[model samples]
Target: MCSHIFNERNRSFSGREVIMINTDAEGIVVDRPNRFLCIVNITKPVTMESEMVHVHDPGRLEDILYPGNRVLLKRAAEGKRKTKWDLIAGDIMGEWVLVNSSWHRKISEWVIQNKIIPFLNGIDTVIPEKKFGDSRLDFLLMEKEKSIWVEVKGCTLARGSVALFPDAPTIRGRRHLEELIKARNEGHEAVVLILVFRQEAESFSANKVIDPDFALTFSKAIDAGVKVFPLCFSYEENTIHFRSLLPVFQKS
Candidate 1:
């Protein structure tokens, strides 16, 4: 199991300027004047696009960073270009912080250490590298005893008693449902786990209007023996705990 700790630092953000930093626990500065920087809380874990650090202004990057905040860089892979920069963690003005990668790492570690390992009952297994499958599979879990493939999708967009997925149309998401059906046919226990990070959602369902194909595939997968589990996350200051499993509403 992997673990992470947060370290606070300060820096300057001049609007669109980007800074590069080492992504380790004890964050280190790598470069300056790159693209964009946004404040993040290192104590909390985040994943996917939610981990981005937004630049508020072009000339104020240097004036708004501070300790206790995580930073994100834009154009992280490519070299410096207009309005692009490597994310360097720092404290710029006051109280303004950037999002850090610690949240995602911590959540991943928790899943392995507390959920997956224990559920497998001492069986040895490997965490497969995450990839963009027919849709996008969050994880591919494998073991000698029983083959288990899981797709993890985050449900952050919710309103009142209703919880929705794929706020936007996702062809890739539709493909993932198809893959789940394929995995089930191959005799593996294929499951879809929707991680609802927020506390408001009480139930979950696929948005038919956004992508009807996804809804159809999901219904077929369920009928074909693929288990769908939507679990809620209980959030504390810096830690996230899995709560009781929620029910999935399959309406086609």
Candidate 2:
């Protein structure tokens, strides 16, 4: 049952515990020049100077990525890329919320590989970024003769007791939902995995006020037999811990 997955910070798969992510450094937010770049003051490992860091996630992040907030960083090898560090998570209300989209694929793979969600237990192989009907879905899971088309979405916005996705309006998100419905109609199992990084969220829903089209499409996809999983996790002490499987609610 899914109830056992809600009991612990880390679970063992055949006696092997999973550490989803690890960071080599910490930083304080100096400024955000754009959606993909942030000026950070490296506070750990003897680097007191300001440097340009890569922000992987494309959300507006207006609520969390503000100046003076403490954040976690994953350092890149010297001279490997334009930015030396990548913004991993941000401190929000004394809790760390994973904001990096680069880690979304890895997190989704871990959940599927470990069979944390009972319905997805037997997924054998995860193929990512496959083009189907002009939409590049995040993953295509294969198990025996079963083909599952999956789209992964990272959600960081939490309000009161609910978690809403697409902190900004996303035409692309709406398109993904439409494609998932198409996949379902084509005799394939389709799923949308909403990874809610906020631990306090008791339920998940599509943000209708921000983008009503996406919200309506989400309900449409639900009616088309496409499954949605709003899995919650907490980022604390530099490790991601499973919190719970949130109930999906259509916000009216």
Displacement of residue 22 (Cα, Å) in model 2 is 2.5
Report the lDDT of model 2 for residue 74. Answer: 87
Clashes of each: 44, 0
Candidate 1 minimal-lDDT segment of 10 residues: 5-14
Query: Per-residue alpha-carbon lDDT of model 1 for 1-252, expressed as tens digits?
Result: 322111111111112111222342222233233334443333323333323343433322332243334443433445554333334333332221333332433444445445432343343564644553445465666667687776766654455654567655677666887888888888877767666544555667776766677778777988888776665554432234555456676563
Which ranges in model 2 have alpha carbons more than 4 Å from their true place? 1-17
Query: Would you estimate the TM-scores of all the predictions?
Result: 0.56, 0.88
The lDDT values for all models are 0.50, 0.83
When summed lDDT is taken over every stretch of 10 residues in candidate 2, the lowest stretch is 1-10
Q: Give the winner by TM-score.
A: 2
Candidate 1, residue 83: lDDT = 34
**Candidate 2 on 72-112: residue-level lDDT in tens?**
88887678588988888998888999999888887888888
